[model samples]
Target: MFSPEGPGLRELAVQALSSVERGYDLLAPKFDHTPFRTPDAVLDAVAAALTRMGPFGNGLDLCCGTGAGTVVPARVCRDSVTGVDFSAGMLAVARRRALPAGPRVHWVRADARALPFAPVFDLVVSFGAFGHFLPRELPGLFAQVRSVLRPGGRFAFPLVAPPRPGSPAYWALLGFDAVMRVRNAVWRPPFVMYYRTFRPSDVRRELTRAGFRVELHALPEFGRRRDGSPRVRLVVARRPAR
Candidate 1:
C-alpha cells in the first residue's frame, strides 16, 4: 500500500529491526509516501468537526509524525499551533513542510509520557499514533495530554471501528500482532506497535480517570458498518473548565 517513492521492502525490514526512534528516523524521509501517513481526508473531516466545537486558541499535535494531523488544529485554532514528537528525525521532516493558513507553527521534540510545556493549549489532536503505546501506558499517556491542556481545552483523536472477527482485516491484524509479540520476545530493543490493543471502552475509562469529560462524535464521511455503527468516531475529551 505504498507509493514508488515510499521505502522499499528491504528498507522497511531494516526499520522494523531498529529501535522505534531510529526506525522512524530512517523512515521519516519517505514517510509521507507510505500508508503510515494519516490521510488528508481523515484530517479534513476532523478539522470540520473541530470547527463546529471550536474557536480554539492555541493548539498542539501530540506525536505529530510528519505533521499530518497538525493541519486539523491549524485550521481550528486561531493563535499558535505546536507539534510534539519523540523522534527528532520525524520532527525535522515535519518542520520542512509548509503549513496551511491559521496559526504559527512550532515543532518540539519530547516524549508523550513527559511533555515539556505549560497548560496553555486550547485544543490538542493526534492521529494514528496511539498504536505505539501499550494498554498499560494509556493512563500515563492520557494524563500527559491532560496536563498540557488548559482548563476547557480538548484532546481529540479519531478511532476507526475494529474489524469484525473472522474477517480478513481481523485475521491480518491478529497475525501482525502475533508477529510483533514474537519479535519482541526474541529481539533486542522492542518496537511497540500493535493494532488491537486500543479499545474504545478502555480508552474512555482512562480518559475519564485522567479528568477529561469525554464525548464521541460520529464522523459521517466514512459512513456506517453493517451493524449501523459509525465506521469512524471522534473522541473529544475536554478538561473540565473549573
Candidate 2:
C-alpha cells in the first residue's frame, strides 16, 4: 500500500495474479493514490514545456491510464483531445475523471501497437507507461505513433535518466526487474514490465528508423545528478514536415 487511500497489500497481490488489463481494472479506483501514478509536478513541467512549443490543434495521450497524463492535451489543444489505451478498466476511470465538456475528450480502447486513427493529432504524449512495452515492440509502436500524426506532428514523453551503476536507484530498479522476471516466469499471460528495457540510445535509434526526427529537452525542474546529467528529460520525436 502506498497511502491511506491506496490499495492494500492483499489487493495488490490479487491484482498481480490477474491479467494486466484485469489487474489495472482492479487497481484503477485506487491507482492515483499509489506512487505509480505520474506525479503532478512532472505533469505540470510537461504542460509548461508544451505550452511553449504549442498552440497544437489536436492531441492524443498514448496509453493514458486513469487519464492523469491525458489532461495536459485538453489544456493546450484547440480542437479535440483523445486518450487511447488497451485497458477498459483504465478507460472507465479516465472517463469518470475527465471533464464533462470543452474541447471534446474521448476515450478509445485500443492497443498502442496498432493505433486506429489517421493523420490526426498535432501532439501526443505518454507518461509512466513505457515499462509495459518490451524493447522489440518499440519499432512498431513508434511507427504506429507516426501513422497517427500529421506532418510536423510530435510524440513526446518524459523519461528519467537511467540511474548510474552502484547507485541505490539503479540497484532498486534492478531488483524490481529481477522480481518481475521471476513472477512472469511462473505466471501465465506475462505482465511484461521491465525497468531496464528502454535505453535512450536504443529508443532514439528506433525512432529514427521509424522516420521521426528526435530531440531531447532537459527537464531542469528535477535538477541534475552528481555528474551534471539531467535527472529527467523530455523526448520529443517529430513527424517530418513533408
> For residues 45-88, what per-residue lDDT tens digits would candidate 1 score against the true structure?
99999999998999999999888778898889999999999998
Residue 185, candidate 1: how far off, in angstroms?
A: 0.4
Q: After superposition, how far is residue 119 of candidate 1 from its true place, in Å?
A: 0.6
Candidate 2 per-residue lDDT, tens place, 1-242, comes to 39999999999999888888889989999999999999989998898888889989999999998999887888789899999999888898999994535588889999999899999899999998889988989999999999999999999999999988998989999999998899999998777778899899999999999999999999889999989998999999999998
Task: Please report the candidate that would top TM-score against the real structure.
Answer: 1
Compared with the true structure, all predictions reach lDDT values of 0.94, 0.91
Model 1, clash count? 0
- Give the worst 10-residue stretch by lDDT in candidate 2: 97-106
Instruction: Using lDDT, give the best candidate's number.
Output: 1
